[model samples]
Target: KLRERLKISGDYHECNETNSSLLLLTENNTSLDLNISRDAVFGNCLDLAVKKFQKRHGLVVDGVVGGGTQRALNMTIEEKIDKVQLNIDRIKWLPREKNERYVIVNVPEFMLHYVEDGEIKQQLAVIVGDRKHPTPIFSENISYIVLNPYWKVPEGIVRREVIPAMVKNPNYLKKQGLEAHQTWDENSPRVDTSWIYWEEYLYGQKKFPYRLMQPPGPKNALGKIKFKFPNKFSVYLHDTPTKHLFKKRVRAFSHGCVRLSQPTDFLKTISTFNPKINMKKATKRLKGKRKQFIKVKNQLRIHLVYLTVGINKEGQVEFRNDIYNYDKYQKRRIR
Candidate 1:
């Protein structure tokens, strides 16, 4: 009956039985109450309930029943049931027992939670990978943190993007702070970009043996700091040069790495738990313009999760968009 009542949609400013019953039924059914009357009128009470519902579900907190609100409200009981069950299966796949410390990033929600002993330490907004380059769901330990990190250009990126861009514009490398090296080694001699045959590799006439790297600087893609974890995906939780991207609501705008909004604060948070991290030395390195890596004495476990539905701190069932369509991958139960 609740699902049938929620079937009504569209922009509802004034009150009718359609909108009134929908809002009242919603408040009664969910963990929300506006003290709204059952009378058929779109009053302030019902409006507050609508916004509250939006906030709980991570939707834009607009009182009007817009496209997004309508879609979420229109979700059938059966569909919501399936979503909850699918996420339950996902939770079961997680670590059976809680650990001393761990961080979990729910990809769908675009938020990271630093949890220790069942308490949340810090929460931060994150920009994850886009559709084409979706952030892989996996678990790993943060091995170390790098200060003034060099943005090492991946081989695939070198061949596909860098080479083509270089071909189009001759001064692209110099302008971008990119240095061509003889090999992938710290002490390797720098190769003159002018000397290398750019066309041969770009045209697939020959394999590019050399490597390209962006040294530690303002032009660096990894910004000033990075949380390094040795993983097969070569992905890291790092600071981004494009800080303005964080201001946006939906923040899926990266190649594959997770971009942290507050890297310095995150560093401080990490230091609080890990005694071995030298805060003074790290501060000095960050101020200086040189690359340095500090090993993590106590490696913190991290899980990149894809959950579309879960209970929030308020104990209300919160819903997130199936950003990666991972929810569809879960097999639905037959009635």
Candidate 2:
């Protein structure tokens, strides 16, 4: 009875002729048939499973899977079931309904999706936060978009990354297209740069001597497009100039911001559901210096989820890696 429950039929041959080394499962003197290649099972299978899982979870449907998918699949069956239950509990985390059109960013899968009229219209690769700085899970309406916008260096980035680099090379800021403005104290009064050497600041004996900002261009980290929404976390979705990163199967290489590979496709998809704005007009508006905020007619649902094990459209149970270690955590958390 236990063997039957685990699908341990003697006739099962868990090997594929195309790839002889691939193994799906072996139990009760029987081998389980595999749906994907053997190499795919351990590596790409988890990646593909993650993509399928992400699609079902209302995320981008890209075929390449990464850390988020690995972490999700590494979860035990009990943990996965718990995640489904948690999703049910947090269903209210999303808006009751959206403007008939909207965009969703799934941090785990590092992808974004555009949906309209209950159908996925476009999908794009995205760069999400690393384990140290996991992307926040939230949802909000996209009020507008900014093209060629200047980057306002975040305070956290300045203290942790930029300031240290500046200390080593005062010219580092200039090379990265950053310009230094006067530094201010609590009184908002300007502090002279000559009084304090910028290089000594790295030793922890000095303060950040100036405000820095990177101008808009190809070298700008924010890329060419930025999607804006109303949120307290100061998080937003945007494009990245580093297009090469998308080629990786497991892309988890970003600060807190979400980076999309195909912003144009996403823009077009969002405009379709937004009756108030047409794609042509939106494109024209983006080209100009003036920014535009086109409200969507229907808000699209967005979900950032992690699923380690799942059934594909073909109804095969798939496995994946545990990238974020979410599976381990979920197992401990779930009773």
Candidate 3:
């Protein structure tokens, strides 16, 4: 009954040389084939079945059975069934309130959905954390938006990246628009590099108590805007200066934060949540090196979720690659 209900498109046709591969793949497989004959021909039933399978697994649903669809097809019947069941459980655990608007970042899919009243209002491509620093999954409320924000270098990054670069080239920090401060506080004093003990911090001989921040500019890592949310993981959504990364099919380049492709468009949607925000005036503030923070009157709910499989609007199954190997890890626990 589950397979019968999936909406299928395309007309039935007799098996031809071109469809021989699709025929052998989709036919005689009880998991995907809904009683289709094992003839070496492409027909209406086979086309529908392939489309249904593609949609259910989050494929392009082109009914062409390309490389991605072929990979999905290669999964055994038991594995496919297991994936569906696992995702169904995930659905059951989802937030059930229908009236509330929210944002969802599907990690595996590399996409973000701005949902309002159970419908998608805006959709954008997002770059998530890479394999080394896989994006942590959690829920939080967006508290504010920062214009011309400063990029505070995390400790891990400072140790692994900034320190080494500085050791090789003393002027590296200045060239990169980074400034060293005495402390991490808002009113902390900036420090001149010449007077600081760089060697001690480099060799771990002494604790690095100072903070490194990249001020707002065209070359800034965080681009021009940043969306702040309340989360223990210190992960939030922001714009990226490396615009070419968004063009890639798989965008897992961040250290641990979500990078927005359409931050300005997202800002427009954010304006609706707070009466104090006038997007026209806010756009003017985003210019230059001045840092400005705008707190929202009503916070928006945001969810950073991990789902490799889902059912799309067409009621077809959709699937994505488990980039972090999270599915393998989770399934082991279930077993």
lDDT of 3 by residue, 138-185 (tens): 888888999999899898898878887888888899889888888876
Q: Write the per-residue lDDT of candidate 2 for residues 1-335, one digit (tens) a residue.
A: 22233233333222222222223221211212325544455455534554556555433455333334224434456655565565455454555654565566655556576756666667787888788777677777676776666677877787788778867776677678765556422124343433546656664556665766665676778877787776877877787889999987567787777888887777676665566657776667656544344555555445454544444557755443445776567557764
Query: What do the candidate models score in CA lDDT, each in turn?
Result: 0.80, 0.59, 0.79
- lDDT of the structure predicted as candidate 1: 0.80
Using TM-score as the measure, which candidate wins? 1
Count of residue pairs whose backbone atoms collide, per candidate: 1, 17, 14
Residue 269 displacement in candidate 2 (angstroms): 1.8
State each model's C-alpha RMSD to the native. Answer: 4.1, 7.7, 6.4
Error of 1 at 90 (Å): 0.7
- Compute the lDDT of residue 149 as modeled in candidate 3: 91
Relative to the unseen true structure, what is the C-alpha lDDT of residue 32 in candidate 3, on a scale of 0 to 100? 58
Better of 1 and 3 by lDDT: 1
